[model samples]
Target: MGSIDKYIFKTTLASFALVLVSLTGVIWITQALRGIDLMTSQGQTILTFLGITGLVIPALVLIIAPIALMIAISHTLNKLATDSEIIVMNAAGFSPIRLFRPFFLATCVVAALVAFIGAYLAPDGMRRIKQWDAEITADVLTNILQPGRFAQLDQNLTIRIRERLPGGVLGGVFVDDRRDPQERVTIIADHGTVQKTDRGSYLVLYDGNLQRFEVGKRDPALVAFARYAFDMSKFSQGRDVTLGIRERYLWELMWPDEEDKTYQQLSGQFFAELHDRFMAPIYPFAFAALTFAFLGAPRTTRQSRNFSIGGSVFAVFGLRMVGFACSVMAVKTPLAALVQYLMLFGGIGVGVWMIVGGVVVEPPPRLMEAINRNNERIARLFRRPATA
Candidate 1:
């Protein structure tokens, strides 16, 4: 790279990093707040809360990187224009395509990062999140009951205690379980403690009475025991590590197991996700090219670039929305995925043509005149006479 190219590359990359981190951090905090219950109610530490919540960062970056790249390219181009550097370069025989080299390299870097996150990092993060969430739920069920409150451990199970005693003993324990439609079991114990063995978790109740009620009969079977072990492992088991379409790895999406139940039921989703992953890396390049084509020209101070900038942003947004629509429709019709590819490549082609042909993107003179007239009328309405 030349010295000029290196300067533009460094500036654009620095801007990209700053924008990416700022935007990702803001969004991550909003998402992480949703998991605050882990620390507030589940007896988990702050570090655990952040760790589980932070796993979502890879997924967020998969969406934010392309937008950040576009913003960085726009900023670099605007700065060059503001400093009249673009004009100087143009006078020195530099073409728009020549000036676009640094931005292209930066966009490529961001695109690769997005591709990596989408293919591997995002799926792995989602898998870890599911595993850790299941484990934490188990721990919460076993150890984190609040005193003097009724806790619904599951849809059909409710547990309550009068007070929590030291040494992990629970006082005034009551458990109502209706998981089996054919029967209901209620246990009232004076005191109990949770125990975990190699097999599973159990609630060891002392001085408790168990009442079993069958659905057909009104009368209940009651038994009093000095010590009883109630199995608590059923609630915590079988909830770990299930992969959805979004959680599947790249190769898994490409060559999914034909016999897998999820693949059978959600085959359409698999098709959509596979195409989305393949197409995600193409967006950054399209965005960079469009931005340069719209705002890369040398202009005098009197010429406003606002319309061009707005046009570029609108085009980028429209293209992305089309891609999203195509991805959605691709779930049912596999051919819909081809639309996004066509749009992206077409955008690149148009941008390149405009850049190479030195076409200046501007609003029509009539439209600008109408806008100026409307602005003047609004300004006149807001203006007041000054005191003499």
Candidate 2:
């Protein structure tokens, strides 16, 4: 690569890295705040939280990579124009296509990185996050109860304990269980402890009072008991992970079931997601080109800098939103998919047109005359004194 190309490449890459990190940090912070309470309630260790956070990196990359690339290219080119480097290059007989090569190369490298993360790393990370979340939920469900507190296990079960014993035992226990809709039962025990048997896990009570109230009957029956047991195993089932098109791999989406109607719908969604993942990386380059086509100009005047940079950034954002809307609509209308592809091709066409269309305008005659006059005055000011 020539000196100018190398210079532009380095500048663009530096900008891209800065933007990518800033954007990813913002996203990570948001996710961390939202999940911190759930993690603490589940008694998850720091390492577990970090691991899950790490697993989210690819997902963040999927959103950050394209925007970073677009911003980087726009900023770098704008800087070059503002500094008159582009003017010098043009003066040296370089065309817009020649100047664009470095930026395009950088875009290609970023696109490759995005593709790798989207196609492989993202799916694997999502799976790990799901698995860890499920394990944490199970732990919380089984171990959240504490002594001397009113613990509500679910909608139908509540238990209060006065104290915890050495083992998994409780003293002065009160239990209200309403699993049966026809009858409601309340039990009070002077002492109780959890027990695991061949049948299931249960809480065995001693010296307790039992009250049974039938739903329809007005009469409530009370019975005093020396021993009583209530089953606790029924509440131990872990939470199920939600599997969506984003969570499944390509093959799972394609062949969810041979004979299920839901599978066919899922298969369609998966196909759309797969195509989107593959297409996401290219968006960076396409957006970069589109921005450049609209913004690349020789900054011969102050107005040119403001016009090109502001207009380019606004146009880039607008195009991105349009593309996202089209992708969403594509889920229901196949024609929207064509629109997405057209956006990409349209970006390329714009770039090619910019390269082939020649510079937007010749340097203003008045500005050129003023610049020449300034040079002449400077030369005269620096001249040797006339010979004596």
Candidate 3:
């Protein structure tokens, strides 16, 4: 790249980085505040919360990068115009289209990064977050079974533990299992322990008393047991993690059978997403051209630089909102397919018109000089008014 190209690229990138960081900070703060109660209630550690929050950054960048690029490009160009650098380039016969090339390249690089995250990395991260949450929940529930207390796992099962051993063994254990409607089983064990094996988990009791009550029976049978086992496999299955929409890759969404509604949405979303991924890279170029159209007029001492820059920035934001709204609506309707093209080619057309069609009329530098000279003369006349 040439010196001018390098300068423009660096300035635009620095501005884009600042905007991205500011926006991400705001988003993170909002999310953390909203989930603080849930996090505290679940005893989630700070490291786990941070891990989940970190995974969310890529998704935020995918949404925020385009708008950031647009603002950054516009601001960078406006600064150049204010500093008279744009005037020098104009004098050197470098057209606005040529000046926009560097910004366009930068946007392409950012777009590629966004695509990498949106397509693969973000989904994988989301899956990991879900899995981590499920494991934490399982651990919390299992730890709730305390010694010397009547611990109720559910309405159907109640357990009382006299003592707990260092190896997760319980002595003087009593369990009332009411899962079967036809019969209720009561078990008292001198010793028992929670064991996980290939077949699944079990609570094995040694030197236990087993009492079975059968419906319509004359007498309840009580049997003394040397060893008995109660299956605890259900708890593990209850916490089994299932993948959702954010967990699946783009291709998986594209070929959904009948099993996943998330996949169906993914299929629809992918079309719009793909269009956006490619279209977003060119926004910096469009923004650069728009800035040139709005602010590349001859330098005027009378014009307030801040007002001009603010107006250009406002226009950039408005255009971006329109594009985002249109893209969202199009994703669900047939209109999205065409809207992608409209936003892309329409932006390009505007840029081309501003650069090549001579529609953006630069103010005559001589006119500005004349205005300044006339203002000075008017001031001089006012100062001499006492002679009248």
Each model's lDDT: 0.88, 0.75, 0.70
Candidate No. with top TM-score: 1
Estimate the TM-score for candidate 1. 0.80
Q: Between prediction 2 and prediction 3, which has the larger lDDT? A: 2
Candidate 3, residues 316-363, lDDT tens digits: the string is 676677778766875677576576567656766775676665444434
lDDT of 1: 0.88
Model 3 Cα RMSD, 1 decimal: 8.9
Task: Residues 214-297, candidate 1: write the lDDT tens digits.
Answer: 988989999999999988877555454677888899999999999999999999999999989998899999999998999998
Candidate 3 minimal-lDDT segment of 10 residues: 36-45
Model 3, clash count? 1
Give lDDT: candidate 1, residue 161. Answer: 83
- Which one is best on lDDT? 1
Measured against the true structure, the TM-scores of the candidates, in listed sequence, are: 0.80, 0.69, 0.65
